[model samples]
Target: MRTVLHGRPLAARPRRQLRDHGDVHQDRLAATFADRCEPYRGYGAGAFTILRKIRQGTPWKEAAGSAFNGQGSCGNGAAMRIAPLGAYFADDPKTVTTQAIRASEVTHQHPEGVMGGLAVAHAAAVAAKARLTGTPPPDLLGSVLDHLEDSFVRKGIEKARRIQTAEEAAYVLGNGSRVTAQDTVPFTLWVAARHLGDYRAAITTCVQAGGDVDTTAAIVGGIIATPPREWRDEREPLPDWVRR
Candidate 1:
């Protein structure tokens, strides 16, 4: 949500929000994550390490790239938080892709990790556009796959396109079981594509799939639906600093 609020304005006023070379400034994003992400709670090990590096005053790029002994992280962390950025730039596919890459690189530098963010962002962008147009997309996953290059994530999505049930998708696509982008994004996208108009059903399906349920539900929820008022009231409120 913060990324969307911060980044949406950048579309109209790039000079104000972006650096001279047109890249997103990572300082604010890093600070946001540092303040909100607890070390050992629900965050993955890669995310914990990257956030620790940022808090230690390491440069954002260096901090992200240093994870996993320089191999960088290929975890689903980036994809999980990127849907809002996608929705914010829903009308601009190019910006969606570019900005999603920039945002993911702040915490996930591995190509697969970055691609995971790109895929989810692109899916959200498409979903938002469909909502605005009041027309359901005929091929949501197809559009997302079109924007991606060959990767395990892409392959999983390709398989998702063929699968018919959430159970099958979780089985064939790995259901966030490995907690990698390859294991998570495809299954979430599959759920979102199936229940684009039914938020409750979408979330229920995610939970039933059973691996990394929270992350999968978060990703799917971010793309397809907003929580009901009662649902929102049941959870801890957003930080005051978070813009609605």
Candidate 2:
């Protein structure tokens, strides 16, 4: 239980500076985290910078949009640290998507960003539900996809359903190379689906697929690891680093 929640921040921190700080007033949250945690020390660049702008009194919509000179960010940041929220609301797919949107809008104001978070949350909710019901692992990806409204995300998940291996998933659905929500979430859900019954395999799959490993692993790991310990006995024990 504790181990599961702990995994989310550990997996998320190494890839990016932010820890999905929720919807805090950017500067206050930034200062608090930056001062308290060693990991938040020097890593803020993309989303963090935008967050800073918001803290300095810029509106969230404008601050986020100005990140790439008004292009806004579609980064996987929202998706990377959102699994816990999904698990927390495991019984409600509608609430998962709705809340995911609110969560992402705090920093990730782009449609793609919000979509990515929603997709991951919806998947986690489905995964959590499956765990609760003892459902088998077939069509898990389809279940996750059913809750999404984004066309590109839907198409990507559709592609993921046909893919058999993580390597193939990475190649076709993307492995987070672009860092956009579209480039990250699809493949993560695929990996999560393929390795839902085994936590270690899910993490390994993300590492092997290779782009933005930490974030992908965080998203996949968080969702796949949500099942109770009894349901996941086949999963390898936590790695040394994770346990420590």
> What's each prediction's TM-score?
0.87, 0.75
Score candidate 2 by lDDT: 0.68
> Where is model 2 more than 4 Å wrong at Cα?
1-44, 226-244
Candidate 2 per-residue lDDT over residues 171-194, each given as its tens digit: 999998787788888999898888
lDDT of 1 at 126: 89
Q: Which run of 10 residues does model 1 get worst, by summed lDDT?
A: 1-10
Candidate 1 runs further than 4 Å off: 1-23
After aligning candidate 1 to the native by TM-score, how far in Å is the CA of 178 from where it should be?
A: 0.6
lDDT of 1 by residue, 95-128 (tens): 9888888888888899999999899999999899
